[model samples]
Target: MIGQVVLNSNIMSVNLGLGVVLVVQDGVAKVSGLIGVRSGELVKFKKCGVDGIVIGLLKDSVSVTILGSDREVQQGELVERLYEVVKVPVGYELLGRVVDGIGNQADNKELPIELMEKALVEVKAPGVITRQPVREPLATGILALDSIVPVGRGQRQLIIGDRQTGKTVVALDTIINQRTNQRPVICVYVAIGQKRSTVSQIAARLKQEGAAPYTIIVAATASESAALQYLAPYTATAIAE
Candidate 1:
């Protein structure tokens, strides 16, 4: 007999299977009545049709970071638990495809079910002793960088400089060079807080260079929320793993 109930402007109750939004502030909402939920679990706002993630479990309510426009969330809105943590599609099929910050396919095509697998977006890094050693070299196709500052597989290289300094070009070059490598190397390019046009140009360039077949672009554009931009790198890492 459980159903939706509205107590007041600040509180609303729904069926036992659902939760009520208590307060929303700065893209985080406080919701109550959800049972057996864990942090990082995904939830949906029924009315707004947007998703959120449980970030903190309070005494009687849970803190949710909205994945979409927080302005759409209202007090007393019903929330449904997805019963799963945030996950991204990972596999060879993702190569040459563009995905959003949360792993949604953005290339306007249906993802092939058989070629994809879901992976948790958040995972702890393995201990140093258990990690693989970086012994093989990864050429960036940049003569100066490869000759003076060689990069190894599984190594991290940072290209930092002022705007319009070709930082993106360097990264794109590295991705393009992977195509020439003897061993197959999958490159994941995560664009956080960049403009949509910029991401599009990068994708087009990669395609023109014949590197699109081996590279995946995960873009969280500047117009997206901070939460999404923050999650972009983790989502990319999960897909790569």
Candidate 2:
């Protein structure tokens, strides 16, 4: 009934309930049915099977690759997905262990279900789904701090030293390092001190590393409510997760 358009080649297709959509364009009519639909995308309104080929998905349309050449399609034809009205990631568990903001488990429990279909997938800690060996070095720039600190992939390492020991710098470096890895980790910097220069430096560094897309920053200083500061990291983590 409703799904995101994922592809449109000889056949138009979408991520249906648990499968892909297949719409035959040329076989029935040919008004440039498959003018859009490439990889890494979503489509809505239409539905079909995972393996079946369809004809068109003007919505969220990207030029589908054919035998040899590629072409452009009307982006307007594709529709962006509206957020769902589903309840929170409850009927779930999130305790003890540090978990992302979403209801997804951060501890060692296995998921009970599988997402066999593709719809409007949300940012669930972004890369928590992709596992890469935690071997690539993530530099901290500060010699003393760098030497003493270590963070594993998907780790929940907290910075608990005294004031002015460069905790922010440590966070900044990890954000920058993500640019060099094949599967980079996402960083959500939550600054409680309300330092302007520090946040500015972070923005500049993110541009340098080309990792801005994967990083999120939250700043709340002395005057703001303690409640806000306490909740900042969790909020950012939830969005990223």
Candidate 3:
């Protein structure tokens, strides 16, 4: 079956099936008659002009989370399964730019060059045999941290504290310290549920400290839809990998 694809306001002719919106809820929507729908597939609501991703599959319906705005979607609207999953631009071109969860350029600056490489937002991890041990330390440049709680490469560490604590400051400092390190590392900072101003300040700080060129900021600010916030971390991790 043939389906119409609407991308960034442009309609492209492709062979895919279309589903009809059966229900709509807060950040969630249900579509019927999409037999080929797959998890993570991008779906566009024709009437509302919003994008969503398939999150669940029922016997007769597909559950989706609208990416940005979902208030305009209603029952009986046409939902086109783009057949392609959500992808993010991955190349040197994105190093210093701010992007949303789906890798759309958030900065107003025009891209200097076209991004030729795109990576799927969802990916599987490398097998155990392909991985190495974490013996090398990733210096944070903070004397207290380096001395007390040294982090190793490939190690996952969580920093938790009360509000107004220096959690963000520590992360920013670590990113900045990588500039002088002998080993090269690409950093991706995912900011979820943060205020827009707060994320902007963090991006500005990274640029000022010369870390922007080696870092990618994925932001899903507090004002954005819940779906974006939920996917921010996964998107950032995919970029880093």
Candidate 4:
């Protein structure tokens, strides 16, 4: 079982963690006195109510990217290791809902229904022998593209173009089209570094078009912390898988 430990330098113990903020940069904190902490592990500033992710391990200190406001975390504050990796909630109940990069509800409604499982943001891919081959065609409901470049079930297709070229529109349309598929297709829409107004517009459109029932919107808006934008895609992949 995993146990929680509060590190106090004054009263050191084997199970207790010892971490002190040595430096506070733009959005990262150099913490000292932490032992046996791994990269990607979550940590928190006890007095600031801010969490961080360990990004680099130095000889005497660990570089942690602050997940919230860095200005709130002061130097010499106590740092506690959560002893857990970054994770997000996953379940069918996430459908038709909106969440932030860390899986917090963003729709201004009650928390997402029945979040029965949590998945690590980063995980190893399945072996080839255990994975299904990408043989079946997956239509995008776009005539020109379907005629020119066909997409397969398990294929990675890139939609590349200059700015304002309707790339997002195409992707949104594809998600809308999945509503008519023979088998139900769960869709996850991830918006990274986008404006909150834009995300709200997309959500409204999806709901208006009757596609919101099976779609999950994961948003890390530009107004939020950069850590959230960095975690947006990984969180989406974890939930989708």
Candidate 5:
């Protein structure tokens, strides 16, 4: 289904490039007639205000990953390049809250505090000269993990396993362990393609264990669009940094 395109008066003042949806395929839409759009730029479908991000530059069109309900978009619908990059909300106020990939509250409560600080979702890493060596240990408090595989403050560890495996358990334990650690590290748990109930349970567990004060949950449930799931990790990382 396609919604009627509505052009508000502010659109002209914003100098947004206008385009038309040429094709819609599996969470992606091909848009034509847009100019000056780079990969990762945010765009909005004029029809229903559904957000999308430019993922690829085609010969004559741009491939945009639709971030919201894709069912509201259709071929020939109007699109407007927002002329802005995707950003996520950042601040201490985000602690203990469940947010979506875009940093909007997912717990169904009205966020009374205004989130004034925002950061771009994508950033370039610092050069070697600006980097610092990892000297501190990030203890997970799990005897099995601490003895078998110790993780440091700046190390990257990948926990992989089949379905029903204890991958999430390992991550949750590490997060919960931070509650009593000497140097507490803020934790941001990103849930991608997970059931809503599973995300809720994790949040509840964190709160019950007294770790929610220093943790944030970014959830893109299984029911959400693929675009959101793709953005979840980056969003969580931005919040963590």
Candidate 6:
């Protein structure tokens, strides 16, 4: 759980988890793979005829290798991943229309099923779409900006200018456009070296304009942890996806 784990190598056995062992007993002790357990220097668990052991100290998905006479830890056991957890996406397209959050099929009144994979904010468009032409115009949500500079869908708009030239303002306006158009694109703002007051102010503004649910902000001015800042966009993207 800490660094990297290879469960396939030390797979003792596979279990139906029906209070039974699926392997041949070697001696007085019988080890069950249905025991979802692990062992550190501190704790371990077992599912034998003794008192049911539940190791509370180790992290999730613990691995254990019990010792017994003439017993061997086998491999290639298929541990069923039949987890009960489920995640639902906010936005899903149906028919010919789009929708906002809360599982409403705003487009064609079609019901979306429980998605197996969580939605991602950003993903590579299908390979077939990669070669499509950028013919559709993407309104950047600002009248003044778009009148001066228009951005088409699949367009890469590069904002290159000196400080205080409204680079961030341009980005915000584009995000705002999505909400108005009913194709609300999620925004993940990574504010590097930004003032704390400025970040707070912008967050407040976004929430006021009903953009907080689809908006995520990460600022590097507060924490020294680089990992936090690095993974912030991916988290936001996953939520949007």
| TM-score against truth, every candidate | 0.90, 0.38, 0.86, 0.91, 0.87, 0.42
Segments in model 4 whose C-alpha atoms lie over 4 Å from true places = 1-15, 112-115
The parts of candidate 2 lying over 4 Å away from their true place are 1-150
Pairs in clash, predicted candidate 5: none
lDDT of 1 by residue, 1-101 (tens): 02232233123333455888888999899887776679989999999999999999986778999998899999878898888888888888888899999
Off by over 4 Å in 1: 1-15, 113-115
| lDDT tens per residue, model 3, 1-241 | 1122123112222234777776778989877767767888888998778899999998767898999777788876788877799877777777888888777777887754354577888788888888888989999999999999999989889999999899999999999999997754789899999988998999999999889889989999899999888888888887787
Top candidate by TM-score:
4
Backbone atom clashes (below 3 Å) for every candidate: 0, 25, 1, 1, 0, 7
Q: Model 1's lDDT to the true fold?
A: 0.86
Q: How would you order the candidates by TM-score, starting with the best?
A: 4, 1, 5, 3, 6, 2
Of the two candidates 4 and 6, the one with more favorable lDDT, higher being better, is 4
lDDT tens readout by residue for model 2, 156-181:
56777897896766677767766667
Q: Write the per-residue lDDT of candidate 6 for residues 39-122, one digit (tens) a residue.
A: 211111223212212222233233322212213323222332222221224432221222222122322345554543445433
How many collisions between residues are there in candidate 2?
A: 25
Which model is ahead, 5 or 6, in terms of TM-score? 5
Per residue, candidate 5 scores C-alpha lDDT tens digits across 96-164 of 899998888899666644646889888886687777787877889899788888898877899999988
- Candidate 4 structure quality by residue, lDDT tens digits, 17-104: 7588878898999887778889999998999888899999998678999987888998778888899999888987788899999887
Which residue segments of model 6 deviate by more than 4 Å? 1-133, 218-222, 233-241
lDDT of 4: 0.86
